[model samples]
Target: MVKELDPSLNESEFLLEALRKGHRVDGRAVYDMRLIELTFGSDYGHVEIQLGRTRVAARVTAEVVRPRPDKPTEGMLLFNTEISPMASALFDAGSRSEEEVLISRIIEKAMRRSRAIDTEGLCIVAGEKVWSIRVDLHFMDHDGNLIDCACIAAITALLHFRRPDVTVVGEEVTIHPVDQRNPVPLSVHHIPICVTFGFYANGELMVVDPTYLEEQVQEGSMTITMNIHKEICTLSKAGGIPLEMDQVLRCSQVALVKVTDVTEQIQKALADDKVAR
Candidate 1:
């Protein structure tokens, strides 16, 4: 297993000192998030997200498949996350690391478990066939806060994706090509955005969108998933220093604000893409 080179003691101390003095090496305020940039591909359902130095690409694809017996009517939403070795020295090609696993799970919870997309709407035939919507997330760069970036990429791609039209007659399903029939958009119920907070100084100091060096120097972190409706989808704190109730609430408020901004950005980008095409 490859491991990241830990930051030196001096480097760590310098970052902490700067944070304590109310400054970040990247010049972002404690509560300020990094600028987010979205790039859409020529094909539908392909998107790339740039959050500062971090980069993630998401592609959405669908296929007709047998549905599960227990939930025959509901379509499947699957996520596959790959962290390239070129993204970081800590990652090995064609292998899943602990970090990659955690990121994938978090993304699953944020998007799939939250029911952001209308899975039941994907059913073409009850108990027999359903559209299996798969989201492939490729982590091209690992700066920090991969969970948030991956969620953004996946959700944006899903929103931009248009599946082929299908017709059924007497148990016979006919798939129409994009050229023959216009593709239809997915029935997305809501958008869930993830906002991560890195805690420092024993939880007294928290920063939004910590960079790679800040993540290394931080004591702990919490990830909050919320939608534009001000609904909390997930709150994840992994073995970090315990946070006070007020702190958790404060994080939720911040998450809501950030989620609103991101949702608008996604909508605007999609609108712009439609106009361009």
Candidate 2:
């Protein structure tokens, strides 16, 4: 069963009315996301993201390793996180908290579901060896939603990272260092962006990009990751309450509309940066 609203009934009702009237508490439309700012190449393989006050940074590195027995021709992608104490009081440095685990799982699920990276292309000599790419996410701020910000950071960093070329001579494989002359980019087929929305009161009150306060009060939420082709890559719904099929479909419709704009914004940012460089 859906839970009742908190004691702040007036504020909640006001926000709901505002949303019904096509205005959010933050003055954005129901389908609008927060302002996004992206910075690439701050370091060798680093990307920084700013979604409102929430900040996340990711650095990617690669190394050659033996292929897994089950997937001999595919490379591996590992996602790690370092939750600094400065980022939030709820997180302590070097400690694996519940939030950290959820963050990692969400990222892993999104990548696996979307098949964003072309792992098979990383194979050097088939079963002999393959490249393993590691992405490290550093949480600089915890404004509200970590999953959305982290996913954005991860995708942006992967897009900007370049790997050194590899050559196989007989039984031996050689990996070259990245320099101005030889730099290879990762095989990324599509760009996926995640959009999250809060559902309340029999799905009557819906809001996009919920703030921390709204997240705390909401009974249920859904997240959708859509690729450049407008395909649904990942869909996650949580909250003990059960929702009707029509409600689920309605959420997907709203989410797709928002993801279109989000993906375009990210692509535009990347393109603009390339032009500036």
Candidate 3:
């Protein structure tokens, strides 16, 4: 079996000691996130998000297709993620990784399973045809805290996406081009954003967003997905040393604040784009 080599001993030691002393290499507070930059392409439903050094882009497309046997009345929403070497060296990075799987699951729970999109609205002919929405996610960069960044990109793109105008006449479907008719937006119930906290010093010291170096030395981490309503869509803490109850509760409260700030930022970005359009 091949094993990954450890980080440089001196660099690792420096970061760990700095964190223990409440210092970050970037000179930011423990809770201060790196600057967030969200940009939209000329095309609707395409969004690019840059969280510090990590960058992600999401593109959403729609098509008409037969509905499923069981959920015939509902439309389909598919998510595919690509993490190329351009993103990070840790991954192969074109293929999926355990990290990729974890990121995908959290996003699915927060955006899809939580019923964020009104699938019923996607039905054109109940049990016969429906709209199929596919979101293609690309990781342009991977500094750290990728799951949270990816989730933000996914939900934001969904909010910005619109399906074409369609009419059904006696089992005949007519689709109108964008120039012919304004597209209809998706039925997004809510925007669920994931907030990640990295624990250090035996889970005693916690940071709101950890970069790659912190990730290497941190003891464990937790990701909490929530919306502007303070509803927790999912709380994820994969295998690691157990955290104290106080840590969990404190992180939850902090996560809400982060969620509120991020949600507002996204709304502002979308509104700006709408005005520009």
lDDT, candidate 1, residue 55? 97
Clashes per candidate, residues 3 or more apart or on different chains: 0, 0, 0
Q: Could you give candidate 3's per-residue lDDT for residues 8-75 as a string of tens digits?
A: 88987888778778888888788878888999998889999999999999999999999999998999
- Candidate 2 local lDDT, residue 243: 72
Return the lDDT, model 2, position 272: 85
Model 1 C-alpha RMSD to native: 1.1
lDDT of 2 by residue, 1-277 (tens): 2333443878878876776787877787776778988888745468888887888999999998999999999999889988887776667667798878877877887775578999999899888899899999999987767778888999888887888898789999877776534668888988777778787766777777787656766778877777657688877775635678887778778777776777777778778877886
Which residue pairs overlap in candidate 3's backbone? none
Could you tell me which residue pairs clash in candidate 1?
Answer: none
Q: After superposition, how far is residue 90 of candidate 1 from its true place, in Å?
A: 0.6
Q: Rate the local accuracy (lDDT) of all candidates.
A: 0.92, 0.79, 0.88
Q: lDDT per residue, candidate 1, 154-205, as tens digits?
A: 9999999999999999899999999899999999999999999999999988
Give lDDT: candidate 1, residue 174: 99
- Give the CA lDDT, 0 to 100, for residue 232 in model 3: 86
TM-score of 3: 0.95
RMSD per candidate (Å) reads 1.1, 4.0, 1.9
Residue 39 displacement (Å), model 2: 0.8
lDDT of 2: 0.79
Local lDDT at 246 for model 3: 89
Q: Quick one: ranking by lDDT, best first?
A: 1, 3, 2
Model 3 regions lying over 4 Å from their true place: 1-5
